[model samples]
Target: MSINAKSADHSPIDEDAEQLARLGYTYEKQFKREMSFWGNVSLGFTYLSPVVGVYTLFASSLGLGGPPMIWSFLIVGVGQFFVALVFGEIVSNYPVAGGIYPWARRLWGRKWGWMTGWVYLIALLTTIAGVAYGAGTFLDALVGAEASTASTIVCAIVMILLATGINLGGTKLLNKVAMLGLIAELSGALVVGIWLLVVARQHDLSVLFNSFGAGGGSNYFIAFAAAALIGIYQYYGFEACGDVAEEVPNPGIRIPKAMRMTIYIGGFAATFVCLSLILAVPDYAAVISGQDTDPVGTVLSGAFGAVGYRVVLGIVLISFVSCVMSLQAAASRLSYSMARDRMLPASKLLAHFQEKRHVPPYSLLLACVVPILVILGSIVSPDALVVIVSFAALGIYLGFQLVVLAALRARLKGWKPSGAFQLGKWGVPVNIAALTWGVLGITNMVWPRTPDSPWFVNYLVLLSAVAVVGVGLIYLFAKKPYTHSDAPAADAVPPSGSNRSVAENAQSHHVENYL
Candidate 1:
C-alpha cells in the first residue's frame, strides 16, 4: 500500500520513479505531477458526464425499450462496478500515464500492450467525434430552425478546437476547467432531475418495468438488448483518471480511488437522472408509438416550460464541452506515453513534451486533427454520428476486455498483485466475473441492433470495429514496428538533455522530476 510521506525531502514523484523501477522501466518524469485528487475525480466524472450522456442517449433507449430501459442503468452499473474493481487493482500495481497499455505490458507482454493502446486510442478519437456531434445536435435544436448540416458541422469543429486549446494551456488550466465542469454537471443534472420528477412527472414508478413492445414479441428481449447501449456507453469512461496517472500524486493509491469514485458518482447520477427523465416524459403514448422521438426535450420542455428548457440545454452543453476536454486529455497522454517508448508513428515528434507548457504539443495536435476530420465526415452523411457512436462503444469495450483478459491470464499464471489494493481471496472470482461481464457487454454493443435490415445498415458497427483492428494488425505486421526492448541495458542510453545514463541515474534524490 502507498502512503503519504511527511519528510520535506520525499516528493511524490520520487516515489513514482521508484515504482517505475520496480516494474523494470524508467520514466524521465517530464510531465508535471500537478493533478489533485479532486482534479482527477473531475476528469473521470466529467468524462462520464450523466447530464450529457443521458440527455443525448435517453431517446434511443426509450424508443427501443420504452420505460423498461431504465432498468439497464442499475444492471450496467453493477456489471461495471466489477470492471472498475479489476481496473483499480491493476492501476494500483502498474499505474502509468497510458493506463491500460503500460499495465498490460507490465502484466503480459509488449505486443499485448501495443494492441491495447491501439484500440483505446481509436476509441478516444471516435468518442471525441461522437460527443462533439451530440453537442452540436443539441445546440442546433436549441437554435430552433437556424440549424443546418453546415451549422452542426461548424459547431462540432469549434467545440473540438476549444478542447484542444484548453489542453494546450497546461495542467493547471485543465484542472481549473475540470472543476468548473464538475460543478456544472452535478448541479445541473441533479436539479433538473429532481425538479422534473417532483413537479411534472406523468407515469407511476411501475411504468419503469414496462417495455411497451418495441420489437413485436411476447417479450421485448431484442429491444432491451439494443437499449443496453445507453447504459453501457455511459459508464466506460471511469478510467480516464487512470490514463493520466503520471500527472497525479501517489497514483498507486490515488488513481485506484479515483476510478472507483468516478463509478460511484457517475452511476448514481446516470440512474437518477435517467429515471427522472423517463417518469417525467409527457405524451408517452405518442413517444412509445415513435411519433415523438425526442423524449428528453419533451420532458424538459414540459417540466420547465419552453424558455426554461433552453436554459437546461445550455447547462448540458457545458457538460459536453467538459466531456470532450477530458477525452482529448486522456487520449493525448496515451499517445505521448506510447510514443515516448518509440512504439508509434512519428515517435520523436509525438514523444516530445513542451517543457515550457508542460504538455505534449504534437500528440495533442494528432488528437485534435483526427476528430476534426471525423466531424467533417459527419457533415457529408446526415446519420454519420449514429454509426460513429456505435463504433466508439465497440472499440472501448474491446480495448477494456483485452486488459481484463490479460489480468485473468496473469492470475492463471500465478501472478499476484503487489499493490496495496490486492483483492486477496476474491481475486480469481472477481477476475472471472470481470471477464464474463466484459464479453457479455461487448457482444451486446457489437450485435446488430437491426438484425434484419440491409447488411450495411445493420452491421456497420461490427464491420467498422473489425476493419479498424484488422487493418491495424495488417499495418503492424507489414511495418513491423520495433517495440523497444522491455528493459534497456542500464548502462546503454543517456537521459535526454542529461549527461548521465537514464537507467543508472533513474532515481535522483535531488532534482525535481521536471527534467
Candidate 2:
C-alpha cells in the first residue's frame, strides 16, 4: 500500500504512474516533466530572492532592532529548515501538485485540505501583489520616475501582466527564467556584499551586539520579534519547489533535495547580504535615531556611486520580477490543483490546461487577475493594502502549520511516511519541533507591539488571519465544495499490516458506512 514500493520490473516512470493510480488519480502524460533538480532549486531560490528581501526590509529591521537584527536570519532559517524537512517528507510520499493542498488532503481529509488551500491561495495571491508592488517601486526608481502610490500600482499591474505572459508560455520557460534569476540574484548579492564589506565597511563585527536603544530599553525581545519579519518573509519561498512537483522527473527524490538546497543556499545568501549591508551603513546611530530614512539606498549609492547604484538597482529589479514570476507560477499551480479536484468555483474552467503548452491557462489567468485586482484596490484605501500585505507571511505560516498538524494526526493514526526521504525515528521529534517553531513564529508575527500605531494597524496580522479564516469557514459550510469531489476523505492509513491500498481502504470505509 506504500506509494514508495518499487518493483524491479517497473521503470521509475511506470512506478510513478502506478503510485498515482493507487492514490485514485490518473497520470497525465501531457504534463511535461522538464525541470531537473537544479531547475527546481532555481525556482525556489529566485522566489526566496535575498536581494528582494534584504533590500525591501533593511531599513525597517535596522530601525527596529539595530544591527543585531541581522541574526534573525539565522534564527528564522533554522526554524524554516525544520519546516522544509517536514514538507519534503510529505511531498516525497504524495508527489502531488498543489504542495500543501494535496498533501493535507491525503493526510487528513477533504475539508482540512479545502480550508488549507483556501487560506494558502489567498495568501499566495496577496504575496504576488506585494512582490509586484515592490517591483514597481524599484522599476520606478530605475527609470528615474517619481514614486507614488498611483505610479507603483500602475507599474505593479504591468509587472503582473508580464509575469503572466511568461508563465503562459509553459514550464520550460519558467525553468529557464528561474535559472537566470538565480544567477542574477546570487551574483548581485555576492558582488554587492563583497564590495560593501571590503570598500565601505564602517562598523566592526562588534557592532552586531549593540541594540542602539531599540525597544526603548524595556524589551529587546519585542523589538527582535518585530524585526523577525525580515527573515520570516524571505525563508518561505522554498515551498515553491513542491508547487511544481508534477513537472520534475523523479520528483519523489529530487524535489526533497531541491527543497533542502533552497533553504541552505538561500539562508546563507540572505545572511551574508544582510551582514554586509549592516556593516556598510555610514552610521547605525542615524538609522536607529530616525535620521537616515533610506539607509539601504544610502549605503548602495554611497558605496557604488551614482551610475553603479543604478546598475545595482537594475539587478534588484530583475530579482523582483523573477520573484513575482515564481510566485505567480506557484499560485497558478495551487489553483489548478484545487480546481482539478472540483473544489473551487468555476472548477471546470479553472482546471482547463492548454494541451499544447502544458500549462493551466485559466488557473494562470486567475492568479494574474486576482493580484491585479488587489493592486487596484490599493488605490482606494492604501491602509487596507498594508493590512492585507501583512497577512501574507502569517497566512502562509498558518497554512504550513496546518499541514504539519495533519501529518502529526496521520502519524498518530499509524501512518509512517514511506517516501524516498524521511526522518525515521526523528520524524515525531522533528515534526513537533517544526510545529512548535511555526506556532512561535505565528505569535511573533501577530503580536501587537506597536503602541503608537492605530489599534487595527497594530493588530493587522491577527485580524487579517481571522478575517480570512472566517470567510473561508462561511463559504465552506454554505457551498460544501468537498461534496463535489470523489477524492478520499480522512484518508489516514489504518493500523499496520493492511494489504489493501489506501484508495481501496477508503472505498471500503465508505461501503461500511453505507451499511
Best lDDT goes to which candidate? 2
lDDT for model 2 comes to 0.85
lDDT of each: 0.79, 0.85
TM-score of predicted structure 1: 0.91
Per-residue lDDT of 386-475 in model 1, one digit per residue for the tens?
A: 666667878888888888888888776556565546677788898898889889998887676665789788788888888778877876
TM-score of each: 0.91, 0.94
Clash pairs, candidate 1, are none
Per-residue lDDT for 390 in model 1? 62
Model 2 segments beyond 4 Å from truth? Answer: 1-11, 27-29, 495-515
Global lDDT of model 1: 0.79
Q: After best superposition, candidate 2 residue 169: deviation in angstroms?
A: 0.9
lDDT of 2 by residue, 1-515 (tens): 24444578766666556656666668353467777788899999988989899899989999999988988998999999999998988887777778999989989989999999999999999999898888777777777888898889888988888899989998999999899999999999999999999999998999899987976787898888888789988898888999998888777778888999999889999999999999999887788888998898899889998889899999998888889999899999999999989999999998888988999999999989998988898889887788888889888999999999998888777776766677888788888989999999898888888689889878888999999999999989999999899975566566467644364442221100000
